[model samples]
Target: MELPKGLAGVVVDQTKVSSTKNAVLTYAGYPIKELKDAPFEEVVFLLWHTRLPSADELSEFRKRLVSEMVLPEKTVQLITRITYEPQHPMSILRTTVSLLGTTNDVKRDDPPRILAKLLTAIAAIIRIRDGQPIKHAQKGWGVVENFIYLFSGQRPTPERVAMFNTVMVLHADHEFNASTFTARVVASTQADYYSCLTAAVCALKGPLHGGANERVFKMLETIRDTGQDPVQYVKDQMASGHKIMGFGHRIYKNGDPRAVILREVARKIAHETDNDSYFVLQEQIKDYMFKATHLHPNVDYYTALIYHCFDLDKQTFTMMFAACRTAGWLAHIVEQQAEGCLIRPSSEYVGETNRHYPSR
Candidate 1:
């Protein structure tokens, strides 16, 4: 049998968390367009349990997630010590997740608590690296609101919260993406949640995956700061045989559904934050890329602008991706562990397998 490179179109396992069927993203059978406006906690609950929660259940779930957002004091100390300038945020995050497993009461931990702690820990990494004090999650506010406050050190307006909540909901899951699949493979062995999450973080650090957004922003900054025409920049880069970071995806031939939703959020937030120039440049490049290459923008394209509007450093962008994705990772980990099967697969021998060594 012939197999495609990188297991393209291969079905290794099954999952119900999310799907990009026909290039339309859905979480638990609900279309992404419908869920895009739902509360982030509601969407997370859906991904985990495969159904929407009732009003009272959502309220209680929000409270529980917010309540668990506080990191243990020891974890905070370790984070402060390791979050110096040299280390990448994703590196800090990988070690921190591993530390959470070892330093906390991890034996009784569930998805909600693990998700809450990860959000808090990611925020703490941002703050500590910036020399700002870590902010606590507010009890009354929802997860997205408190998460923004925790990292930015300011409570955002309700409108801002709504925009960010949509961002989180869109990013919460996608069926068996690289990082999610990595988590599942680890979880197939019944490994601990943090171990699974740590492996997922490592996979997301590659430039082709979660790191693409940062490179997208870097391209925008290059065009704006160098005063190069956006189209010319694209031409020159393509001439040099460099792949534009955010133009296409393996699954979405026409366009990414999430990018279609996030474009409006990027526009609104960019204008509100007085970062409209960057968004304008993005539009120019986006139009030229499509006309030049017939490629549509993927989710990473606009999300780079959104993160820039939020005043995040480009280096920490993938860590933010990891934060939203941890929900799906935890869900898959739970599912794979419950299934209780190892994911070992047979490989075809392509080397000189018939040769025998006479002496060594």
Candidate 2:
């Protein structure tokens, strides 16, 4: 395919980004194989900074991340208002982000302290809105640690905490996806960064974006209630011309590397949690998918089962994904700022061009 205008392949943005090779590469350019066995916390430091941190560096970073988890009082009130009632997670996230423009330092994006607060703001809003009592970072822990603690309401177990960290690291950045593109477009206009982020979040709310995972849960529920076997469910849905929620991808000709990584996590979590239902259902779907359409699982596919294994509510799956993805969003934003170009795109106008109004 011919590269479109705007350096369609020029790569002006140097943000922490990756490609799908069925091979993993983090924003920091670290190999995925090396990270696969490393602690998730370690990988996060790698992404935020170019090199791995020393033990002391890790300790200090943890302290900062933990402290950052505390949301502002006004933000708390905003989240409390929406999450208090039954609401869509993506709507709550995007709207709160738009409202966040009131508190951002868009013009002063260069200040380190100001930028830290912005990162904290996004993470805190998601946690606070989820009915999770937010926790500020401890004297020593950094942004990620504070998030894990606030999210789970207690100090996370070493292993589970690592899982959380790895997830954030893995999701830290992807190259110019829909939401990232939205954020970049808004930022190009010198508008509020939060406005860009809010636009991105709204884009993510679409079923084709982050919302598909929630739909997967609904699919499972429907199948269970209808007492249909997995094979039968796939057959009926396909016959009716329905696409499975968690299979196939535009980029992954072989498979999503993230899906493979997450699938292993799901297996470990499933075995540990002793939830037979998730894996049992997963197997059924996998079989049915292969038999019916040759479609295999994607990241969101296993994520639904994994969250259920974590005993998380179906409503908040997207928010959890958002939490991890916030890192990626920031990475892209900073990269766009470095490029310093307005992200204006031209449209082919087909309306009447030279027509003049009748002289009265």
RMSD of each candidate relative to the true structure: 1.0, 3.8
TM-score of each: 0.98, 0.82
Candidate 1 minimal-lDDT segment of 10 residues = 348-357
Question: Which candidate number would show the highest TM-score if scored against the true structure?
Answer: 1
Which ranges in model 2 have alpha carbons more than 4 Å from their true place? Answer: 1-16, 21-24, 37-45, 54-56, 104-137, 140-145, 349-360
* Each model's lDDT: 0.92, 0.66
Tens-place lDDT digits, model 1, residues 210-253: 98999999999988999999999999999999989988888888
For candidate 2, lDDT tens digit of each residue in 1-360? Answer: 455654434454445555443434555676664566565445556655657899988776655555444445776677667664556766777676665566444454432333345445545554665556565656655455555555555676667766665665566556676777777777777665676677777877778778778888878878777787877887788789888888886656566777788778877888889866767777789877877677777778878877776556777778777766665666566667667789775566769899889999
Q: Tell how far residue 21 is off in model 1, in angstroms.
A: 1.1
Clashing pairs in 1: none
lDDT of 2: 0.66
Q: What is the lDDT of residue 111 in candidate 1?
A: 96
